[model samples]
Target: MSFMPPWFWLLLALLFFSALAGWVLQRGLKKQALSADANDVQRQANRRIQQQHLTDLDQALAEGRLSPAQHAMARDDMLRHVLSDATAAQGNGMRPQVNAASAGPVRVVWIVLCLAALSGWSYAQLGAAQTWWPLPLSQRVQITATTPEQLAEQTRAWQQATQSRPADAQAWLTLARLHAAQNQHALAEQALARVLVLAPEHDLWVERAQMKALSAGGVFAGEPWQWIQQVLTAQPLHLNALVLAGSAAWSEKRHDAARAYWQQALGLVPADSDAAQGLQQALAQATEMPKLAEAQASQVVPVLTPTPSGGDTRPLIQGEVRVTPEVQSQIGAGASLFVYAVAEEGSRRPVAIWRSTPTAWPVRFGLSDSMGMGAPPVLSSLAQVRLVARISKTGSAQKQPDDWQVELEGVKTGVQGVVLNITGR
Candidate 1:
């Protein structure tokens, strides 16, 4: 049970802010009034000096009414008196803030205001940051849902908001920012992806992509590096992407590559931004790292070889699917996967074909050709792929998947090192 309702808090905040503003205003007014008073004093002093001169000249004329020389001398004396008085007046009156005692109230008000602000900020930091104690626990908590359905509902609301106003890049960015804040890497990735597709010229892609990269790599396990490469191809000066790329590389011990990427990006970003600072630091560290051997070991699936007479292989499986096997099936949370196989140890890569789920032969999970893993595939470019797969994103679903099966086919060339994860009963 609480007596303070929403309006009560609202009123309190309003009053608090109003008091602060009023205090500041009063101080400004006090300063202004002091200036005005000084100006008035100067004006009064000048008026007195002129009066004194007139009085002097009249007295001298009355006493020496007989001689022209004496009258002239008396008039000169009067002029001198008036001029001296006017100078004195100008010096004192023109100096603003002649009344220092009157400003005490204003100064006190400012002090009180500062103390009030400090108190409010302190209260907010302690009570709000941890737990709101003044109100009931139910009302005090900032409600965030935990159930899968609730997440979906919230995600749906965000999606609907963007859909209703497709042109709102800021809304998209806001949603992306929210997702990034929650470490919802998949959602953030989708949001950034939308930004790229909708507004290519938007200045936020590099930044958003950087956030996505960290979120994906740190918690969610998505294709952060690949997406970053895509962003880099489009925008070379993307600050976020560069920082993310460097971080990802350095994290995995690819110091040379990280340094190179950082050096490329350092000049394009704000000097004061954390990313730029990190770039400079990474570049310095990378120079001292001893180069490691090029990574070549990979578990590979087999590829079909073309017939010398241009004839198909004896079995359709020979040409239709790739033979991709991994060194192991188990991997750690942050481990990388590499896949590659050749007919001969030294020969070039082979073509990979696709097969449906529960295939009679080895099958890859994609719509087109290319057997590949992200880690190994990124290392080389001679590989061509025309494969696409529908992967479940963000894996937030609590229920088990219905199918452990997928399909793979070929388009132009086959890729290597990709692993298919399917879970079905």
Candidate 2:
């Protein structure tokens, strides 16, 4: 049912009571008027009877049926009774008092009270009684925030709302989108996690995956890719999921996979819409990227300067990441390749990381100090490093069963040529 405000019901009640009270009072007044008319008719009939008796006495006296004294006494008696009736009729005006209980004002008051009670009871039963009281501050919806101050206030309000009503999945979803809008990907992912627990719809799964990927700097590895896979498995033709999957492939340089996903999604959207136009543009870009890559392939490695600034003259670690033909045949177009270098000792965090799709075998790869994860422990600072290349079956950084991997340990930084053949897991 659609929501109705409290004042609307109250006003409707008042109008109904007014109409009913007017009707009841009118009925009572009409009854009293009918009773008064009946009494007036009876008074008139009594006067007529007294007049006929006086007339008969006069006739009798004229016919010598009675003496003058008798006639005079009878006539005087009749006249006195007629005068008394007139005085009494004059004393009691047009409407005689019928009953105190049947008064118009009393009936109106009773009607008002009864109607008020009935309205209150009916509203309590059929209407939203909570609307009669103010809602809690946290439960109230905030207007769209335009300014930073307003955004902060709205964020706090939504946070309080989620805290107060922890099971409200819609509230959590809204808060997640709000955080996403403000570019707070980590916070958005956290809020989306609540939504996943409370209401794990397919669309929300795609949204959570997107938020998580954004939090991980546009890398759809591990959990994010898993979420996307779950959604695609459930709803193969879901439009938003298709779009997101295409974008994820595009991010991993899987142009063919990206083009396929976008093509499917493009068919679902309206031809003239902005979404369709965007998909078309992405498809066009994906189509041209492979050609560009092939054109620049020969010139790519030779153009790289072999020396470094800071008086360190050492070539970067250049390598070929290859997969066996049998294993390559089993890989899908969307599979991801991770070539990274970590320190020989200490933390396993990659000092340098590069990601791409292994569409072709024996791919040229390069790693240098500049390719580090923008943190401490530069690649050049390490004496020796562990060079690892792996092909993820699920297009994720994390390894799973049946993936292909190869590792080269004790590889010095700035190694001239390295070949890592990804064998079967």
Question: Which predicted model would earn the best lDDT?
Answer: 2
lDDT of each: 0.47, 0.72
Cα displacement (Å) at residue 307, model 1: 52
lDDT per residue for candidate 1 within 86-107, as digits (tens), equals 5785676554455564765767
Look at candidate 1 and tell me the lDDT of residue 338. Answer: 15
Cα RMSD (angstroms) for every candidate in the order listed = 18.0, 15.6
lDDT (tens digit, per residue) of candidate 2 on 165-189: 9999768877876676554667878
Identify the runs in model 1 with alpha carbons over 4 angstroms from their true place: 1-160, 202-227, 230-235, 269-276, 288-425
User: Lowest summed lDDT over 10 consecutive residues: which window, candidate 1?
Assistant: 307-316
Whole-model lDDT, model 2: 0.72
lDDT for predicted candidate 1 compared with the true structure? 0.47
Count steric clashes of candidate 2. Answer: 0
Supply the TM-score for candidate 2.
0.39
Q: Which numbered prediction scores highest in TM-score against the true structure?
A: 2
